[model samples]
Target: MSKAYNETVALSQSGALAALRAAVEKAQEMGVPQCIFIVDPSGETIASLRMDGAKYLSMHTARAKARTAASIRNATGSMTPEFAVAAGIASNGGVTNLPGGLPIRFGGKLAGAIGVGSGTGDQDIEVGRAALAAIEADPI
Candidate 1:
């Protein structure tokens, strides 16, 4: 039998919150507060947290990173300099090449993405990874 619609896996609110909490915990462990954002496969926000002392402006980048990862089904920061610039401009800053974004997959299905900011790119990635681990999702 063939169906026109395919079953879709989505990120639950609880999963999103768990990821956010785990990301915050990791940020605390690293002594760097951060803005963490989680988005669904369609780039809809699920949960987010801006820890105390985290850069408020960085929240925007975090959102962009999350949306970009979910939209592209790939981790951020892989884009080259030229593509990064072009994509950022083309998307009007909706997408970014920042290193903090990671796609989340569950049961071999794309679930969503997470983005961490207000720290060094490596640190951000570390926090994002912690979030992914918390949800038992496949690492990006």
Candidate 2:
């Protein structure tokens, strides 16, 4: 038997680092200490940063949120109640129903995801969006 495969794109390490830096800068601008996480489409960590004074719990939550976005290929907070329940089971508790996670796309493909924590949900989402904007401006 033969198997077929299709090409896929993933966020490069440099791209992930750039996104992390952008999130950090955004957090600083907002005067909010935060934990920022970037992960590949497979939910593997590419880069992460925990700002000074960020809550320890944010470390775990940030990564979980990124994984949730990557796994679902959508913003974590956009999931419907039923989809959230299903995603939670499918991700084995790695999914987070939070507003700070966003799927990263490049060249019309799912590249990765970014998540921010240790701030209000809206602030976190802002930081994540800033990161995505940075990545878009300087692609890898």
**Residue 68 displacement (Å), model 1:** 0.7
| Every model's TM-score | 0.92, 0.85
Point to the candidate with the largest TM-score. Answer: 1
lDDT (10s digit) by residue, model 1, range 26-53 = 9999999999999988889989889999
What's the lDDT for all of these models? Answer: 0.90, 0.83
Best by lDDT: 1
What would the TM-score be for candidate 2 when compared with the true structure? 0.85
Worst 10 residues of 1 by lDDT: 1-10
User: Candidate 2 local accuracy as lDDT?
Assistant: 0.83
Structure candidate 1, residue pairs in collision: none
